[model samples]
Target chain A: MSEATEQNGKHFPEKQLWGREGFRDDPYIEAESLEVAGDAPAVILPLAAWLGLDDDVRRTSNRRIGVFVAPGESIDPLLDKLDTVPLIALQFPAFNDGRSYSKAEILKGRHGFKGELRAVGDVLVDQVVFMLRAGFDTLEVTNPVALKRLSASDLRDTPGYYQPGRGSAKTAGGFSWRRTPAA
Target chain B: MYRYDEFDHAFVAARVEQFKDQVERRLSGELTEDQFKPLRLMNGVYLQLHAYMLRVAVPYGTLSGRQMRKLGHIARTYDRGYGHFTTRQNIQYNWPALADIPKILDELAEVEMHAMQTSGNCIRNVTADHFSGVAADEVADPRPFAEILRQWSSLHPEFSYLPRKFKIAVTGAEHDRAAIQTHDIGLHLKKNEAGELGFAVYVGGGQGRTPMVAKKIRDFLPAEDLLSYTTAIVRVYNLHGRRDNKYKARIKILVHETGVEELTRQIEAEWQALKESDLKLPQGDIDAIMTYFRPPVLPERPEGWGALAAAKKADAGFAAWVDQNVTPHKNPDYGVVTISLKPIGGIPGDASAEQMELVADIAEKYSQDEIRVSHEQNLVLPHVALADLHAVYELLLADGLATANAGLITDIIACPGLDYCALANARSIPVAQRISERFGAAERQAEIGELKIKISGCINACGHHHVGHIGILGVEKKGEELYQITLGGSADEITTVGEITGRGFSSEEVVDAIEKIVDTYLGLRTSKEENFLAAYRRVGAAPFKEALYGPVSRAA
Candidate 1:
């Protein structure tokens, strides 16, 4: 039931969040009270709280449901419910703690999750490229340097990548040594 | 040597521009030191004791004369007129200004080189046998596969931020000159029953505060499955490796905690999904890379044999140099020459800017313009013809690069200890100098035979002390520096970590202790042919221990 501010105690409002379509109003809000699934139109609850919901409530609710997963938290419990969840936000508690990168890959590449994958907390400019490549479709940036770079579209990266990632076909082709230029 | 194509050029250029922008932001105070530390590390810049140390990658230990000249230019222009070649087959400049790094990187890119992934928690420069293609005993060339790994591991997003750094080594010979078993992942290139090239894979081997030999995970992995299998292993490690403690973060620790059986199972499971993905290497791509490493055509220089024999007869120094520093090449007319960097009483692994340029000139005129940096802190001309030996020897002799100690006792490997490294607890170079001078007599060294003495200033084992025939570890005890010795360690086909021999010795007492061990070995050895390691393995540490600490007390 903790409010979803920046995990590192930084103040990044919902407006600072970015997605594929650029900055927009965030429709989903973190459920403040997990006791009863509140009345928010779209609520993002902790993984345990979302899993604790009644089968009927989870399956038949009219409100959109998302889940926030912390680092080291297994995604096995949500495997069967991937279809019902519209978003899965992974926390980076610290930029160097890369446990969330593995979770994101598991969700997108292993489980074939089609929902939005967002990276939240401690997101910095240097890690943005890696986050994107690790299947993060959105980022909740809090660092001022990262925010400036993101706004200016100054995310510098090499033209080609050495490893295949989610949606790699549209961006690159063939083996890494002889990769075709990204479209 | 692998040449950079247009795509490679663009890739390095993009990285240069990116780093340039990052440096600008750091200078403008937009990024704090904490934020910029990792960024600089990714580009191979480290904040050392006094100044920044820049480590430039020499992929697979292969370099052209032009590239070597550029490295010399970098040393002369930016650094203090010298550079240190590291055990990982890369060159490190000890002093460089933070602001001037961008310009240095730009210059490196011009020679198809950069410092990407040289540090940080990413995959480091892939090393191979210095005598890769020319080694007479090689099953196949390892450089092409090494180059393939280099390209794949570079800028790999999923693995850029791992629990700790990863190192991969490849060797094509049965002799294991690349020290495969001491690497995180060792690939031994060999042919199968049907004569198809593949690799015997070993994983989790490392040397540090805790040194462990890598266990064989797979008997043989097909060449096409190289990338997929490697991806699977790294992915498994990235996901499950311990994050709470940095010391236990390496894949070796995970291999220990998870047990090899379970770790192998996990790696296999992860690899199953990726094996059929785009990670599978195409035959054409591998062949294309192999095309770049094709041995340069050398015309038969049969007359050099007669000239070499005459030169040897005339000059005993030249004879000793040829007898020690030269190895058989794949081509009978050619010989693999190891130019020793360890002069008597000189710092190990250090080469002056002028010496580098001279080596480059020698490599160009005689060695088919190819040069290689050995992990043992030496330069190699892998394809020198026998006919050119006298000329090459004369050139090297004049420049003090012709030290006749290839695998002899005086050919020591020592890391930059308290002298330059911030992490070092004691000095390594001075000890190496003392040991080198103590055994400087050519006849004495030749009589003692091959003895490797690797020294590290700390437990990090940057000097590969764990694998030394006689390993020396420097630690700060109380307020004084103490040196500990280990015996019978080797980094060869039969790899074993050295065992510590009783208590440590003070700096003054260390060289004498080493001399005592050598004298004991000479006394008890089965024959002169028995090297220090073979003799130690046979006699065990009992004799060396008794020689140092005296026989066990019967009263106890």
Candidate 2:
């Protein structure tokens, strides 16, 4: 378990949140109580808690809101409410459990969600490339070794791909054969 | 054989470097064994009972003489002097140090060969009909499509982490030699009424603890939509397949529980969205890949027929080898040569480095540098001219590769069970050896014509025991090894799972039990023309069961 650390007068887990640009401060805190809507600047809640909020409260809340979806949870309930949330975190209970990958594809490709898609748990360096391909823009990495590798920018990957993904299409439309200079 | 272009070479080389780093991290204790298991498996490295076993992919079972030579070099340098050819058309080295694997892969890469995706939950090596181009009945070669799949599924980010391992097989012939019905996705290449090439797609077929024949979802899908349609099927399975139970995780279980009609509807719906997407293959690209598999420009050998006739009349042993191990090729002057790896009383698929190099040399000299490894654990020279048959036979005879038992009783398919694999309850090779010894007589084997004996070490069915005409399953029962016999299964056009007979036989009694079954078949068949499968199908398993268990067990 990650220890809670204080920064900028806000307390959150010592999880390194990163995006394509670089490491950034994690603003959203986990909602302690869904019964009382707190006045925090930003709050992240479980799927059920997010779904339990009143429509008027959801519309009127000044705080930035996000929902974390568990492994087997369906994203159907959040489809119509995509515009109200700026971040949607998909949890990988274990690195091998890949149900969230389908969810990520559905959220980005089928539902056309423009929000920041984040991978929350068990995020490792080996899987980060796949996470990026599956439409995750942000990652909450807690593994110490993965963090060290990420900080050193030592990600290992091939120069070419045989299939297309949620990432930018590098090659002009033909057959999705994209290759970069060897890393 | 498809030569590796610059892109393909770069891809494989980068993967080699990536794995080398992963291995280094594992040795340095930066990555624990638990974290390193799947990574190593993706690169075809497995921690076996005795040592690390590396399985290298022989794409669609086709190889060049140079590639075969490279495999021999690897076996001699990094591993023991021998390598085992698996039913998936891949070769496995039973003993290779973990540190030596990177070097082995580097050697493989030099010859445009690799072990990528040979194991693991991701898509495994795509297999096809071993006699793809040379088979007389084939409409077109299936290797091109298999190559397409091999590239697309190489490191597919979305489908790499699947619920369970997936296998796909393809066949272009009317007679199904690739065992398409026993794969996760089986593609039958054919031409429709409009004379357009397409595929009849079958999904969710597998053999394991629970064996099920694949169900056809689409009668015909255009060739251009191959990748799109495949992506659709895999996506649906990856999202909705059962993950709670590892045994029930295969797509076959999903098709069973979800019902064929419903699963087909889901796959079709998913395909509808992706049919016109960027995944749709371009015709030019398909043509480009197809060019790699075009039939070799064979020289006319009109003199071969006269020369072969004279040679056959002179040598009886060469005549027997020709009769048993050769098949009709599309070219009139050529014959397809099956180099049997299963010598009498020897291990089923084990080939020594010397044998491999010898095969390479023969292929280079007589077979247009083309070699294929059959899924039934045999090597094939797909384009040997009839004129050169005697010379090839002499070369093979000197090395003990001239086994005149292609479809005979001695050509038993056995897995490296308790001897090498960590997941075995009983030994398969020794049982195979004993059975081979019992039926080593050529005349006796010829009497039991076209009998397929497949043995599996455990319930995982890697040896494909379920589809054998006489399937033998080895299991551990009450601290002793027991063998179960199944009857009447076939993997041809009309595929059927074998039926288990009553009771089991101890290791000592198993060979005798098989003898009784064979004896019963010989006694009951109307004529020698009736093969074991045809006879068993016509009369049912009653006679064999009676022969195995006697009259009293029937009443029980």
Candidate 3:
């Protein structure tokens, strides 16, 4: 990754830990995210604050986000506070919770904030593409996630079912609405 | 019923192709399951307990005979010959293979339908009063606005995602058949002295763990401002609702924290900006949309209804069914027949291919080819001639769709719960079944009178226990299944959230407790019309609580 965009800021941790070279050796990557590929090169954030992205603000969801939401709160205001962060990773908390899908969707649709949105916790293959469609641009897939297993989107005969914002860009019809206006 | 115009058809067709492509991408290994889940869900597909369940939108629960036949065809071909009608007034095929979902969606699109946003956290299928335009008490048909909401919320670019899935229900009738109080947004059509169309808006009403009746935000939101006003509310929710915790993410939590007044103020502020946008409903558009939902032409009445009524009175079985199952229609000569989806020993809302086909044929012959799946999980022949009641009942009986328990205790709202849903915390159906069996006797149920017994396996309250005159919520207490009971709840125009009496009951004891509550109501009621809710309210929950817990427990 290029160090150009890397600024001397204390927002996220800067201690990068590498797999081959332990945390004792390479100390550049501060936080590690499931979406942060490889070893010491990845970054991680508190699962809850991951709804904010870099591009546009989208902060809504259709299904459950699969996280515990305490009383006297909603998910969007927390996202509203995420003004400028580029990548936001969410925690599943539990597989049964459906609130996370709404969180991912909000990051893409409601806030319209277009940074790297990743699903880090309890993200099974079952919910991978749903996370993508709900606007998770990156999936910090864990638990020995098979790289060789057939991708769910690959099973589609026609690529462009509907245009997803965060993770996917390819489709047959190429997004019915987000097209470049037929120049 | 809103008919699909060219635009609607085009939209469905486009969505179908989009899903087809999505399916192809999944098959070709181009997308991971992680990548494919949301795409498929947006098209209303879900991988459930046993297999992939494809839910098709019935759009405010309205369907044509042809649509029913297509559902039947798909059931026969793609599923185990049956489909489940949901509390949201949609239908689900429980066993469709993942490979065939595209085919199912294709078939659905052919009949002006698609499963779009049926499952995901997007705007779900809009719901309304099953009686809708033809209810005797209605001032206006809410379906036109429901349709308008459906169109605007359909594939909306913004507000696509939030902290959780959203639900909207509208009603024009004084009787709240749509269960508007439990929805995220409930719109009640109102007409003031000026006769200007306005809506009494309720926000933050939901069924999950924290069940609260939606607070009224706007007593009179004008006609022209429906879309923009809704936009403002959704936007406010989108902007302010919680992102930290999923449980506290619904608008209800927001309203609870910021208070409804503040939420309303924020919405008003947002509306100020959007009210002038293109989102405002134009008179021409409103007029045009309302045209499609014009009441079905009624035929002059014949004189046999009186005779039929007399016969029904003499025959206890038929009388009980008629009293519970039939609803008053707008026309004096007509009555709306509610075909119960909950047949005894049969799954609630499960209709086989043959059953769908039979109902379709009956709808075409009897109800002018219009059918509405109600939020109560019953099918309604909205414009059935009163004279044709006997024939429709006979036909329904032949197909096992005629379960004479409409307002009776067996007419229950049960979520698929743990049996099918991955989100469920407990099993809802078996409890519903046990309750149905316990109250199954026609004479006994008739004696109980119109009582709504709603059970949700978990706090999601999909079973609508919160609004049930007698609401049962199943929760796990220390690894054992326990049931909590609430009383005096009503989902009508004078909606009130149910109040929990005291300690919960064990699973085996829950039904007995409910029977005790009913017994108390019967013993205390002033008259037959002093129904369960009315009786409970008149005396309060103390009597029922005393009966269920016995003397010592009541003091505790």
Best by TM-score: 1
Q: Rank the candidates by lDDT, best first.
A: 1, 2, 3
The candidate that wins on lDDT is: 1
Tens digits of per-residue lDDT for model 2 on B1-556? Answer: 6777778898899999999999999989998999999899999999989898999999999999999999998889888899999999999999999988999999999999899999988999999999999999999899989998998898877788899999999999999999999999999999999988899999988899999999989889999999989988998888888889999999999999999999999888988988888778777778778777879999999899999999999999999999999999999999999999999889999999999999999999999999999999999999999999999999999999999999888888888999999999989999999999999988889878889999999999988899999999999999999999999898877889999997879999999999999999999999999999999999998889888888778622
lDDT for A86 (candidate 1): 91
Candidates' C-alpha lDDT: 0.89, 0.88, 0.73
Better of 1 and 2 by lDDT: 1
How close to the true structure is residue B375 of candidate 1, measured as C-alpha lDDT?
Answer: 97
Candidate 2 regions exceeding 4 Å error are: A1-13, A32-37, A54-56, A168-183
Docking class of 1: medium
Interface RMSD, Å, model 3: 8.4
The candidate 2 chain A region of ten consecutive residues with least summed lDDT is A1-10
Q: How accurate locally is residue A145 in candidate 3, as Cα lDDT from 0 to 100?
A: 26
Q: Candidate 1: where is the Cα deviation over 4 Å?
A: A1-11, A32-37, A167-170, A179-183, B552-556
Candidate with maximal DockQ: 1
TM-score of each: 0.97, 0.96, 0.77
Model 3 stretches astray by more than 4 angstroms: A1-183, B27-29, B306-316, B554-556
- The residue pairs found clashing in candidate 1 are B304-B387
TM-score of chain A of 1: 0.86
Chain B structural similarity (TM-score) per candidate: 0.99, 0.99, 0.96
